[model samples]
Target: MQKIDYREWGVDTLFYWKLLIGLGIIVALGGLSALYMEHEGHWVTGMTNLVVWGTPHMFAVFLVVAASGALNIASIGSVFGKKEYKPLARLSGLLAITLLVGGLLVLVLDLGRPDRLLVALFNNNFKSIFAWNIYLYSGFMVIVAAYLFTMMERKANFISRPVGILAFTWRLILTTGTGSIFGFMVSRQAFDSAILAPMFIVMSFAYGLAIYLLVLMFTFAQDNRVIGDNLIKRLKNLLGLFILGMLFFTAVYHLTKLYGTKYHGVEYFFLVDGGIYTLTFWLGHILVGMLLPLALMFCPRFSPSRMALAIACGLVVIGGLATMYTIIIGGQVYQLEMFPGMTVINEGYGTEVAKYAKYCPTVPEFLLGIGGMGVALLATTIGIRVLKFLPETLADESVS
Candidate 1:
C-alpha cells in the first residue's frame, strides 16, 4: 500500500475567517429564530393542528438522513476495501457528524417544548419511533466518532475495518428509524405504508452522496487540491444508481397505493388534483431531482463535465427538499379520514372533511431550516481547518 498524506485544508486564513463569519451569522440567526418561535409559541410559525411538522421537519429529516448517507464513502473504503475511496474517508466521517448535529439542533429547537428535551432524552418509550431515534441519533454519533478515531489515529488503524462495518450497519438502522417515524403513522392517509423504511434508506443514499460530492468539490477547489476524473466518475455513477433506486422504491410505493381502493383518494390528491403537491411531485422531485440528475450523470456529453455534475448534485438537493415538502407538509395538508363512510363537517367554519388543510411557512421557519445547513457547513469548515480531515490531493496516481 502506498502511503497517502493528509493535511488540513490549505485555504488562506482570510478566506477561512470570512467563511466562518458568514456561517456563524447564519447559525446565530437560526438560533434567534428558534428562540423567537419558542417564546411566541407555534402560533408564530406555520405549524397548525393539521400540519404539525412544517419546513423545519423537512430540513431536519433531510439532514438526519443525509448524515447517514455521508458515511457511505468511509464505509466503501474501509469495509468494502475500495482503495480509491480511502483518501476521502476522513472528510466523510467529519461530515457525517456535523450534518447530524445540525439536524438534531433543528429538531430539538423546533420541539415546541425545548425545556423538556432532557425528559425526552432520558425517558425511553420503546413504543415510539420518535423515542427510538433519540438512541439511534446519539448512538450513531458516538459510533462514527469512534470509527473516525480508528481511521485517524495510527495506533488504532488495525480496528478500522471492524469499526467501519459497525458504522455502516448502524447508519442503515438509523435511517430506517428515521423513515419509520413517518411509515408507522397508519392513521394518516399519506404516511400509511410499509415501503417508507427502505424508501428512506435509498433516499439517504442519494441525498447524502449529493451533499458529499458538493462539499468535496468545494473544499478541493478552494485548496487547489486535485480530484481525479476516475474518482469523480465513480461518485457520479454511484449517485445515479442511488437515484434510480430511490425512484424504483417510490414507484412501488405509489403503485401499491394505487392498486388499493382504500388509498385511491390520497393517490389522486398526490398525482392529480393536489395543486402544489402535484406540481412538486412531478416537476421538483421527478423531473429536476431524479431525471435531470440521471441525465447529467449518464449522458455522455454532460458526464465528463465537472460543472454539469455539480448542477446535477444541486438539483438532487433541491429535489430532495421538494420531496420532503410534498411528503411532510403536503401529506398533512390532505385531511385524514376518521370514519370510513361518514363525512364530518366542521360546524364552526362550514368546512367538510374533504377540504384540504392549509399551511404556509413563515420567514422565521425558512430561516430556521436554512440555519441548519449553515451549522453543518460551519462545523465542516472549522473541522477541516483545525484538523487533517481533508487529503492533500486526490490525483489519479495518489487515489488509484
Candidate 2:
C-alpha cells in the first residue's frame, strides 16, 4: 500500500490573509444585520404573523441540512471503508463542524431574542421535534469532533472505526430529526408527509456532496495541488446519484399529495397558482438546480470537463437554496386549512387569513444568510491552514 501524506495548507500568506479579511467583513455584516433585526424587530423584515420562518430560516435550514451531508465523505471513508475517500476524511469532518456551527448561529440569532437560547438549553420538551434537535445538534458536534480526533491523533487511531460508525449513525438520526421538524407539523399541508424525512436525508447527501466538491476543488486549485480527473469523476458521479435519489423522493412526495382530493388545493398552490413559488420550484429548484446540473455531470461531452463539473456543483448549491426558499417560505405563505369545508371571510383588523401570506425579505435578512456562508468558509479555510486536514496531493496515482 502506498503511504498517504497529509499536510496543513502552506499557501501564500497574502491570499490567505485576504480571504480571512473578506470573510471577516461578511461575518461583521451578518452581526450588524442580526443586531438590526433584534433592535427593530422582525417587522422591519418581510416576516409577518403569517410568514414567520422568513429568509433566515431558509438559509439556516439549508446550512444545517448541508452540514449533515458534508460529513458523508468522511463516513464513506471511515465507516464504509472506501480507501479512495480516506484522504479527504479530515477536511470533511472539519467542514461538517463548521457548517453546522454557521447554521446554528443563524438559527439562534434569527430568534429575535437570542438570549432565550439559554432558556432552550435548560428546558426539556421531548415531545417537540425542535427540542429533540437540540440534543441531536449538540451531540453531532461532539461526536464529529471525536471522530476527527480519532483520525488525526495517532494515539486514538485504533478506535477510529467504532467512533466513525457512531458518527455516521448519529448524523442519520440528526437529519431524520431535521426532516421530522417539518414532517411532524401535521397542520401544515406542505409539510405533513413521511416522505420528507427520507427526502431530507437524500437532500443532505446531494447538497453536502456538492458543497464538498466545490470546496475540495477550489482549495486544491488555490494551492496548486494535483487533484486529478479520476477523483473528481468519482465525486461528481456520487453527486449525480444523490441528486437523482432526491428527485425521486420529490416526485413521490408531490404525487402522493396529488393522489388525494384533500391535498389538491395545496398542491395546486405549490405547483401552479402560487406564482413566484411555482416559478421558483420549476425554474430555480428543478430546472436550474437539478436538470442543468445533471446534464453537466452525466452528458458525455460536458462530464469530462473539470470546469463543467465545478459549475454543476455550484449550480447544485444555488438550486439547494432555491429549494429551501420554496419549502420554507412558500410552505408558510400558503393559507392553512384550519377549518376544512368552511370558507374563511375577512372581518378586518387582522381577523381574516388572506388566501396567501406576503413576504419580501429585507437586505438585513440576506446579509445574515450570506454571513452564515462566510462563517463556514472562514472556519474551513482556517482549519485547513492551521491543521493537516488536506491531503498533500489527490492525484490519480496518489489517491488510487
Candidate 3:
C-alpha cells in the first residue's frame, strides 16, 4: 500500500493572505462584541427572564452539532472502511475540533459571568445533562486530537481504527446528550419527545455534510486543487439522502405532535399562527432550506454544475439555522404549560397561557455568534496554512 503524501495548503497568494486577515478582523469584532455584552450583562441583549436562551444558543448549538457531523468523512474512512474517503480524514478531524471550539466559545461567552468558566467546569453535577455535556465536549477534544494523531503519525497508524471507533461512538453520545437537553423538557409542549435523539443525529448528518462540503469546495477552490467528480458526487448524494432523512424526522415530529389533542394548540401556534415563527418554519426551513437545496442537487440540469452544489449547500446551512431558530427561540417565546388547562399568570411573567413573549436579537448577540464562526474559520485557515491538512490533489487519478 502506498502511503498518502500529506501536504500543507501552502497558499502564498496575496489574495489568500488577505482573506485570512479579513476573517481575523471579523473574529476581533466578535470578541469586542462579547466584551461589551459581558460588561453590560445579559440585559443588554434580547434575552429576558422569559426567553433566556436566544440567538447565541441557536448558533452555538448548530456549530456544536455540525462539528460532530463534520466527522462523517473521517468516520466513513476509518469506521466504515471507505477507501475513497480516507484522504479527507485529516481535514475532517481538523474541522471537528475547530468548529466545536468555536461553538463552545460562543456558549461560554454568553454566560452573564464569563469569568466563571472554571467554576462551571469544576462544579460538576452528574445528574445534570449540561454538566455531562461539559465533560463530553472536553473529552471529545482530547480523544479526537488523539484520533487525529493516529492519522498524522505514521507509526501510530495501527491505532487509528480503534481510536476512530471510540471517537465515533463518543460523538453519538455527545449529540444524543445535546438532543436530550431539549427532548427532556417535559414542561414545554414543543420538546418532550424520545424521537429527538435520533432526529438530532440525522440532523447532524445533513448540517455537518453541508458545512463540510462548503469548506471542502472553498478550500479546494482556493488552492486551485481538483476534487474528483466521483467523490463529490458521492458526497452530494449522501447530503441529499441525509436531507431527506431530516425531512422525514421533521414530518414525523409534527405528525406525532399533531396526534395528541392537547398538542394541537402548540402545533397550531408554530405551524399556522405564530407569525414569523410559522413563516420561518414553513418558508425558511421547509421551503428554502430543504426543498430548494434538494432541487438544486437532484435536478438534472444543475446537479452537474459545481456552482449548483454550492448553492444547495449554502441553502441547507441557512435552513439549518432557521430550524434552530424555530426550535430554540420560538420554543421559548411560547409560554410553557405550567398548568395545562388553567390560564395562570405570575408577577414574573404577566401573561396568559397562550400568550407569546417578544424577543428581538440585539447586534452584540449576532456578532457574538458570528465570532464563534470566525474562531472556527480562523483556526482552519491558520491550521491548513501551517500544517499538512490538505491533500495535494483530489483528482481521481491522483487520489486513486
Candidate 4:
C-alpha cells in the first residue's frame, strides 16, 4: 500500500450549487415548522405531557450518535495507522461535524424554549445529567473541529494522531452521556438500566458507519472517482459486525427486562404485543435492518459490486432509524408503571392500568425531523466543495 493522496472533489458545476440550495431550502422549511410549533405551542405538535420528546428526539439522537460513528474511518487511518483508510479520513471528520451540527440543531429547535439555550449553558443544573450533556455535546464539536484541522494542515502533522485519539475518546464519552440521558430516568421502566450507555456506543458504530459508507459511495460514484472494491469490502464487513452487535444488545435488553418478573408486562408490551413497537423491532430493526443487511454483506453472490455495497449501506441506515424509533419512541409508548402489581385507578394519564400510551407525530414534527437530515446533507455538500477532504482516486493498487 502507498501513502494515499488526498484531494478536493473538484466538481465545479452549477448543478452542485443548485443541490446545496435545494437542501438549504428544505432545512428552511423545517425552521418554519419549528416556528409554527412554538407559536401554536406543542398543542399543535404530537408531543403530549406523556410523550413529550416526540419524533425530533429520535432524529436528533440518531444523528448525534451516528456522528460519533462517522469519525471511525478517520480513526482507522489516523489512530490505527491504516494506509488504506487514510484517503477517506478528511471526509470522515467533515461528515462527523456536519451530521452532529444538524442533529443538535434539530434538538435545540424542538426545545420548549430555544432562546433559553444560553441559560442552559450558564444557569446550569449540576445535578442533572441532561444539563451536563449540553457541555459534552459542545465539547464534542470543538474537539472534532480541532481533530479535522490536525488532519488537514501539514503544519499539524506531528500531532494528528494524538488529536485523532483525543477526538475518538471524547466522542465515546459524548455518546455515553447521551445514552445516560435515558438510562438515568428512574421513572421509566424501559430506560432504568446501565445497559443503555454501551448499547448507544455499539449502535453508534453501526449507524455512523452506515452513513459514512452511503456518503462515500455517492460522492465517488457521482464524480467517477475510483473507489476500490477492496476498501468497500473491508468497510462492508465492519458494517455487518456493527449491525449484528446492535441486534445482540437489543436482545439482551429485552431479555433482561423479561428476566425481571415485575417487568413481564413491559416485556410483553415491547416484545410480543406492543403493536408498532413490536413491528419496528422485529420487522424493521431485526429483519430489515440487521438480518437483510448481514445477508447482503456476507453473501458471496453480492460481494463484488459497489452497488451491492450501497444497497447494504442503505438497509443498515434504515435499520438504524428503525432501531432508534423502537428504542426512543417505543420505550415511551409503553407506559410507565405508576404502581406495580396494582391496577392504577384515576391515573389521569389518558390510559388505564396496563395500557400503553399512543402517540403519532404530526406533519410539523415529521418535517422538522427530516429537515435535520437535510441540514447534514447540505453541510456535507458545501464542505466537500471548499475543502480537499476527498481523494481523487482509490484504484485498488493505490489503496490496497
Candidate 5:
C-alpha cells in the first residue's frame, strides 16, 4: 500500500475559516428554530395528529439512507475486491459519516421533546420497525466511523479489511431497517407493501451515488483535485443503471397497487386525483429526475460535462426528496371512513381529505431544514479541509 502524507493534502486556511463561519450560522439558525418550536410547541410546524411526522422527518430519513449508500463504493472496494472503486473510497466514507450525523441532528431537533429522544434508544420494542431502525442507524454509524478511521491510518492495514466488512454488513442492515420503517406501517396503504423495503434499498443506491458524484464535482472544482473523466463517466453509467432499477421498482409498486383491491382507491388518488403531489411524482420524479438524467448520461452524444453532471445530480436529489414527500404526504391525503353505513362517501374520502388535515410547513421548520443542509455541507467542507479525509493529490502508485 502506498501512503500519502497528511501534510500533502492540507486545505487552505481561508476555505477552512469560511466553512467554520457557515457552520456557525447554520448552528445559530437551527438553535433559534429549536427554541421557538420548544416554546410554542409543535403547533409552529405543519405537524398535526394526522401528519405526526412531516417533511423534516422524510428529509432526515432520506439523508441517512443516502449516506449509507454513499459509503458503498469504499465498502465494495475493501470487502469485495473491486479496485475500480478505491479512488472514491475515502471521500465516500467521510461523506457517509458526516451525513449520518447531520441527519441525526435534524431528527433530534424535530422531536417534540428533544430531551426524550433517548426513550427511543432505551425502550425496546422488538416488533416495531422504528425501534429496530434506531439501533441499526446507531450501529451503522459506529462501524462506518471505525472503518473510516482505519482507512485514514496508513499504518493500519491489517484492521482495515475486517472493519470494512463490518461497515458494509451494518450499512446493509441499516438500509433494510430504514425500509422496514415504512414497510411495516400496515395501517397506511401507501407503505404496507412488501416491495417498499427493497424499493428503499435501491433508492439508497440512487441517492448515494448521486450525492457522491455531486461532491466529487464540487471538490474537483474548488480544489482542482484530479478526478479523471473516465471515472466520472463510469459513475454516471452506474448511476444510470440504478436509476433504471429505481424506475422499474416504482412502476411495479404502483401497478401492483392498482391491481390490489385494498390499495386501489389510495393508489388512484395519488396517481390521478392528487394535485401537486401527483404531478411531482410523475413529472419531477419519473421524468426529469430519472429518465432525463439517464438519457443525458447514457446517450453517447449527450455525455454530460462536470457542470451538467452536477445539475443532473441536483435534479435527481430534488426528485428523490419529492418522492419521499409524496409518499408521506400522499398517503395521508385520503382519510378512511369509520362509518360503514353511509351510502355516499364523505368528501374527505380521497384527495379532499388532505385539505382538511392540511399541513404547510412554517417558516421555522423550513429554516431548520435549510440549516440541516447547511450543516451537512459545512461538515463535509470542514472534514475535507482539516481531517485529511479527501486526498489533495492523486497517487502515482496503484492502491494495494
Candidate 6:
C-alpha cells in the first residue's frame, strides 16, 4: 500500500483563516451569553412549567439524530460494501462525532443543574426514556469516535469488522432510544404511538443528508474541488426519496390520529384548529419545510446549483427542527383534560378548554439556545483548521 500525504493538496490560506476567526467570534459571544443566563437564572428565558423544555432541547436532539444518520455513510460503506458511499465516509464520520458533542453540550446547559449531569449515570431510571438516551448517546459517541480514529490511521492494515458492525447496530438502537423518549409517553396523545420511533429514524436521514450537502458545498467552494455532476445528481435523487418518505409518514401518522375518535381526536384538533401551534405545524413543518422543498428537489428542470442545494438543505433542517417542536410543544399545548370524554361536564367545554396552554422562551433562554449553535459551529470550524479535519481535495492523499 502507498502512503498518502495530505500536503500535496495546497492549503487554502485565506479561506481557512477567515473561517477560524469567524468561529472564534461566535464562540466568544455564545460564552458570554451563557454566563449571563447562568447568573440571571432560567427566568430570563421564556420557558415555563407547561413548556419545561424549549428550542434548545429540540435542536440538541436534532443534532444528535442527524449525526447518527451521517455516520451511516461510513458504516454502510465499511460493513455493506457500498463503494459509491466511500467518498463521504470520512467527512460523515467527522460530522457525526462533532455534532453529537455539540448536542450533548446544549442538552447539559438546558438542565436545571448543569453540574448534576454525572448523576444521570448513577441515578438509573430504568423506565425513564431520558435516562436511557443519556446512556445510549454517550456509548454511541465513544464507538463512533473510535471507528473514525481507526479509519483515519492509514497504517492500520486490518479494519475492525466487529467495530463497524457494533457502530451500525448501536446507531439503530440509539435512534430508537431517542424516539422512545417521545413515543413512550402514553399520556401524551400526540406521541403515544409506535410510528414515532420509525418517524425519528427517517427524520434522522433527512436532517443528516441536509447537513452533509451544506458542509460538502462549503468544502467544495473553498477548495475548488468539483464533485462530478453524476454524483451530485444521485445524491439529490436520494434526498428527494427521503423527503418523500418523511412526508408520507407524517401524513399517515396524522391521518390515523384524526380518523380515530378518542384522546387522539383532541390532539388532532389542537393542530387543525386555529391555534398558534397549528400555524407552526401547517406553515413551518408542512408547507415551507416539506412540500416546497420536495417539489424543488423532485423537479428535474430545476437547476441544482450550490445555492439551490443550500436552500433546500436549510429548509429540510428547519423542517426537522419543526417536527421536534410539533411533537414536544404541540403535545403539551392542549391540556390532558381537554380530551372529549375527560373534560368536566360542568365546564361544558368552553373557550377555556380550547384555549390550550402557552409557552415562550425568555430572552436568556433564547441566548443559551442560540449560543449552543454558535458553539457547535465554532467547534467544527476550529476542528477543521487546527486538526486539518477537512481534506483540501476530494481525492486528497491524506484522506486515504
Candidate 2 lDDT, tens digit per residue, 1-400?
2577898887899999999999999999999999999998888889988899989888899999999999999999989999999998998999999999999999998996897898999988899999999999999999999999999999999999999999999999999999999998899999998889999999999999999999898888898998878888889889999999988998999999999999988899999999899988998889988999999999999988889988999998999999999988999988788888977686253675567888899999999999998999999999999999999999889888
Specify the highest-lDDT model's number: 1
Residue pairs clashing, model 3: none
Per-residue C-alpha lDDT of model 6 across residues 101-150, encoded as one tens digit per residue: 77787788777777777788799978887888887888987888777766
How do the residues 181-279 of candidate 4 rate in per-residue lDDT, one tens digit apiece? 899987888898889999999989998998998988888877888877777778888998888888889889888988889889878877799898899
Candidate 4 TM-score to native: 0.96
At residue 154, what lDDT does model 4 achieve? 87
Instruction: Give residue 284's lDDT in candidate 3 (0 to 100).
Output: 83
TM-score versus the correct structure, for each prediction: 0.97, 0.98, 0.96, 0.96, 0.91, 0.88
Kindly provide the TM-score of model 6 when superposed on the true structure, using C-alpha atoms: 0.88
What are the root-mean-square deviations of the candidates from the true structure over C-alphas? 1.4, 1.3, 1.7, 1.6, 3.0, 3.6
RMSD of 1: 1.4
After superposition, the stretches of candidate 4 with alpha carbons farther than 4 Å from their true spots are 349-354
Q: Is candidate 2 or candidate 3 better by lDDT?
A: 2
Whole-model lDDT values for every prediction: 0.92, 0.91, 0.89, 0.86, 0.76, 0.71
Query: What is the lDDT for 340 in model 3?
Result: 72
Model 1 clashing residue pairs (backbone): none
The local distance difference test score of model 5 is 0.76
Give Cα distance to truth, residue 232, candidate 2, Å.
Answer: 1.1
* Ranking according to TM-score, highest score first: 2, 1, 3, 4, 5, 6
**Residue 269 lDDT, candidate 5, scale 0-100:** 74
Candidate 1 global lDDT: 0.92
Task: Give per-residue CA lDDT, model 1, range 13-57, as digits (tens).
Answer: 899899999999999999999999999999999898778999999
lDDT of 6 at 246: 87
- Tens digits of per-residue lDDT, candidate 5, 302-386, equal 6756666777788889888888778877676555533344433345435553332466778777677667766777778877766
